[model samples]
Structure formats: structure tokens, C-alpha cells
Target: MGIEYVSVDAEYPMCCPVILCDICNKQLTREGVALRMESSTPQEPKRSPLYFAHRGGCYSTISATLEDLYGSGWLELSDNLKDFMTQLAHNFNTPLEHEYTQYKLT
Candidate 1:
């Protein structure tokens, strides 16, 4: 078989406003939040150095990736997944300690 290109859905549901959260996959009907990761250093990795994550998915799906990366709690997710995400951030020179980062529900 030949390589097939995937297409993104351009249509939006009418009943409810679909929103994807950058952090914590919590959909919001009203205005939500957004987070953007950018690396402007002299030395950067291949691919993209800038990443945008928006809460309450408004015509965007990048936020979905953030959700899958970081789950409900730090222990809830796998070390490999966290490492992968952190490594991506590190590729952009992110000064975050993967092991130090915690996601606990109170």
C-alpha cells in the first residue's frame, strides 16, 4: 500500500461548543485558558521549537496531545510518557526537572 495522508475535520458540532484545555483536559463552555511553549535560544532541536496548547478546544487539537501527555496524576501516567514530553520540552531548553514535576489531586 501507498502512504496515505490524514485530513483534519473542519466541521464543528452545533449543539455544544467543543473546547480543549492545554493543561487538564477539562472542557469549558465559556472562555478558557491557553499555554504556549516556545524556545528562542540560539541552539534548538529539529522539528518545532514553539508549541501552543489551548484550553476548551476551540478549533484546535494540539491541546489533545497535552492531555494525553500528562494525565490526572503524575503516578497515573507512565514514566516513559512523562519523559517523552519532558524530553520534547528539553529539546527546546526547558528548565524543568522531569522527576520533580508533580500532578497530585487534592
Candidate 2:
């Protein structure tokens, strides 16, 4: 999985379209984190819709799901994803040093 940006066209009086969290099913704001994931089976690989989650708890919950599916080293599998998460952690002022040891770039 990796981070992705999305945009939508909204009508007058509407500033932006609302995105709901995939984990909690609540409205996702600008502070939310969105990830694009792919699933593969014996036949083919399928692209999944963006998964949205709020920072902190919601983010952690979704992360656990990813870990269960892809194992604990999932974040370390992709350099791009690791970099993105590192930047996100800094931007959100959320320390991920303990939760994600690989988040720090060598």
C-alpha cells in the first residue's frame, strides 16, 4: 500500500466531497490519511479503492489490518511507502518511532 491524493468536483455551496473512513466509517477530513492498496489472487491482481482513516487510532487500526495481511515487514518492503510514512509522521507531529521502527530512514 502507498499514499495517494484524490480530488472531486463539487457543486456550488459544497467545498469538497466527503470521504468516510474505511475503518471507523466516519467522515474523513483533510487531516485523514489515505492509502491505495492492491490485492492479488491466483488469477489476477486487483486494484482496491482508496482506504481512508483518521490520524492516531484509526490509522493504527488500519495499519494492523495491513500487517495481518502482509506481515510485519510490509512497510519495509517498499522504500516509497516508508518514505511517505516518515514524512506523514513528521507532518502530523505523530511519533512513529516506536510503532514503526523502519520509519526512520538510514
Candidate 3:
């Protein structure tokens, strides 16, 4: 048998918009959203299509990624997702000692 190419749909819908925050969106004329795609072939199984999460945070799926971009002036994050970003920032800023202590104290 010869090597046959196989195509598959992405886990998440592709070409979806990456809505950033208000300011960056307006400044860059971007929809505050980005696009992602994964192309692969059967012969090269390792090359199978994968989730190419784009736009959110330098291409990170984690919603907070968008926030980082927004904070860095790379993209604008929407108010709706701001809280998500806020928590993300808080988490990053939190020290490991505090994290461990929080559970212990509780």
C-alpha cells in the first residue's frame, strides 16, 4: 500500500476571531481576534493537524494570554475577558510561598 494523506478537522473551530481589548483593537484596527490553523498529512503521522491557537496570547489558547498581549500593547483585550486576565496576572504575581500557605491556612 502506498502512503495516503489523511485530513482531519481541528479540535476547536479554525479562523475564529480573537477579540482583544478595546484600545488595542482600535489602535491596530484588529478585530481583537486572531486566527489559528493546523495542517498535517497521514504519511507523516507526527505531522497530524494540531490546535494552532492563535491571537489569544502570542498564540496561547489560555484566554489570559490575550490579556498579556493587551498589557504589553500587543493586542487589546475585551472587558468581558478582563476578569479572566486579572486573575491570571494575580496568579503570576503571587509567590509560591503564598500559594502553599493559602491552602495550609485554610
Candidate 4:
């Protein structure tokens, strides 16, 4: 199979990481870089939503962090409010990152 690469400009309140290829949804990590890619480059219209609008990456980190607690001492919390705050803290991180990314991009 051939590879393809597309760039996304997701800005904040919607900030997110620089996803290298929109087609395959590849992320650019601190660990490595995407060196080469090949594909039948689709003609991304200049008026595409990705071109005209500013968007942020999907927020996933908070859910993931809260999920982590289900397996740990966080399960010991008896108050529902405490649990809710913890969940909220976890969820907010991704959106916060999105904002940070937006600021940097602009």
C-alpha cells in the first residue's frame, strides 16, 4: 500500500498537536519524524473546511486519565463530587492543550 500525507491546521480553543497526515491520521511525536510518504494526492480544494476554518484536535486525554483511576486508588473515593472533579480535571487537559496549540499556531 502507498502512503499519503496531508497537513491540518487546527488552532485553539481548539489547539492540538501537529498531525502530520490527515488521511492516515498520523501524529508528529517528539520521538520521531515522518520522512517520506507517497499517495494519490487528492486535490484538497482551496475552499475546504480545513482551509477556511480553525479547528482543534479531538480531546481524549482527560477521559484516558480518569479511566486510569478506575484501576488505582482513585476508586477509593466515596464522594461522587470528588470523582466528578477528578474526571473534569482529566478531561480539561486536552482542550487546554488545544488552546495552547492555537495560540502558538497564530
lDDT-wise, the better of 2 and 4 is 2
lDDT of each model, Cα atoms only?
A: 0.35, 0.53, 0.32, 0.28
lDDT of 3 by residue, 1-106 (tens): 1112223346744453333332232211232332212222323322111112224453454335433433322222233344544664797988644221111110
The best candidate by TM-score is: 2
Ranking by lDDT: 2, 1, 3, 4
Residue-level lDDT of model 1, residues 1-106, one tens digit each, is 1112323345743343333333444442334332333223425441222232333343145545544764321111222233434565677886643332222212
- Sort by TM-score, best first: what order? 2, 1, 3, 4
Q: Give the per-residue lDDT digits (tens) of candidate 4, residues 11-82.
A: 524443342333234452332212111112333212111111011232133223333533211121113233
TM-score of 2: 0.41
TM-score of each: 0.21, 0.41, 0.19, 0.16
Candidates 1 and 3 compared by lDDT, better number:
1
Misplaced by over 4 Å in model 3 are 1-79, 96-106
For model 2, residues 35-100, the per-residue Cα lDDT tens digits are 544333424434343466777898789889876765543222122333545665686976433332
Model 3's lDDT to the true fold?
Answer: 0.32
- What local lDDT score does residue 19 receive in model 4, on the 0 to 100 scale? 29
- Which regions of candidate 2 are displaced past 4 Å? 1-17, 38-48, 72-106
